[model samples]
Target: MSVLSAAKKVFYLPIMIGEWDMATIVETVAAMRVLVAEARQAGKSIGFVPTMGALHAGHLALMQQAKKNCDIVVVSIFVNPTQFGPNEDFTAYPRTWAEDLAVCRSAGVDAVFHPPARELYPDGWGTWVEVTGVTDKLCGRSRPTHFRGVATVVTKLFNIVQPDQAFFGQKDAQQVIVLRKMVRDLNMVPEIVMVPIVRDEDGLAKSSRNAYLSSEQRQAALVLSQGLAKAREMAAAGEQEPAAIREAVLSHIQSAPQANVDYVELYSFPDLAEIAVLNQDVLLAVAVRFGATRLIDNIILTPSRT
Candidate 1:
């Protein structure tokens, strides 16, 4: 077997292997392709965890989960420009390649796929992948082309990495739903796993963007999770009306001094269509601004007759 294949088998053994940084080897598509081919030949079923760099505990959690399920884990750190609008924070988005590599290395990630923009999108690239209906709600309504960019970049990553399974955080509930739908509709063969939202001790959902928040804004940001928790509590206490559950969440966030709601929505899970009642599985999602940072959080409410 080739050296690359042997490395994958050793790195991805069922035992918890120490994190290894493969970002240094990910300078080009040609190199990644060869590495992937070798890993596949070694009987390593690939698992992918894609991120926009600035890795955090939440991202690490997802990577660790992927490591458990697949023989090889590939993590991609590219902040796709196509997903960020002109007025958005793309220019200001965090990039800590060195630190991010450390986090991935600690998570036992076998490979870190860090592709540059020009290489992924080439000059004069015009093709875009858009998902209808779902992108028109919550964060999508405010950020417009956001989900399209996510779908496109994710599709491209899936094609390039060709993993047997992929992992995403539940923090971006809408994103998780959109990707799952895209994979199904397009007949992509990877198993999409939606891991639970990872949060701070104070309940703030961990995100790379959270780095942008000032000390005060950081405290104010907890409202998003507070809203989600309120919704969960109300639902468990016998609230079944979607509007009531949504309002319970919204009111908490709106009460915060720094919170400005972009959108606070309740939608059906996986499908993400609007639901008038909370009698089925649903996601209570919100996107709000604290200072200049836009953060999102959600809670999944399974239906109950109580």
Candidate 2:
């Protein structure tokens, strides 16, 4: 009901709390449930941040936001395989458990749940949670089954953590949209809190996939943010046609030698509906592949008319 002040030093570093041996890092759903129950019984509000391993600045920002609002902040570091396509980088995705835990500690997280895939999705796992409709566009078009996996695992995590608030970064805009819809449709209780994307000093959006980029590709990746900025400038200068705005972004990305763009388009905010005119606040989103790594970025366009 109310935000609680964080402890002077909150961490989960494989230490005992007392004779109880209260380990903050857990690997099993049963252990996680115990921690959640203990926190709730202690009258502490829980904040959940679901993420794959290889925590980054964006993730730290999410944890920081959570710390401000909840007395106990928990982060999950499971790389869900169902979210990745057949040829995608499921095997290659970074999984730095020690480094991730360190980051979580630095962010003052109260607990970390690093569940193995087998424990979460044992054999004969069939049921899934999917939020249809607006999912057919944006990142959904390229990786069709992505959101299905996202929704299912998130639903599971929500049930396990039962957090008072869940923290998420806006870099994954469509993901936030899908998960929020899933919560509403299923009548779940955890509040979805969307934080702004934390970017690098060079304007590139912070992402774990950035580790895959070569120096050249890293430099070229700037097209994503640069293009969005140019498009936003055009919208501010009375460019109301969605087609023109999309084209401006597309051209900028295509001109980069190391860049292979997937999509550059505008959609109605929150609903993700396709729009013909920029008559309302819209999301200017782009997905570009630099070498083998795919990166996504977006900016909300709220044009002011005189």
Q: Which candidate comes out best when scored by lDDT?
A: 2
Clashing pairs in 1: 19-105
Off by over 4 Å in 1: 2-24
The deviation in Å at residue 229 for candidate 2 is: 0.6
Which 10 consecutive positions of candidate 2 have the poorest summed lDDT? 1-10
Q: What is the lDDT of residue 140 in candidate 1?
A: 83
Clashes of each: 1, 0
> What does candidate 2 score on TM?
0.92
Computed on alpha carbons, the lDDT of every model, listed in order, comes to: 0.82, 0.86
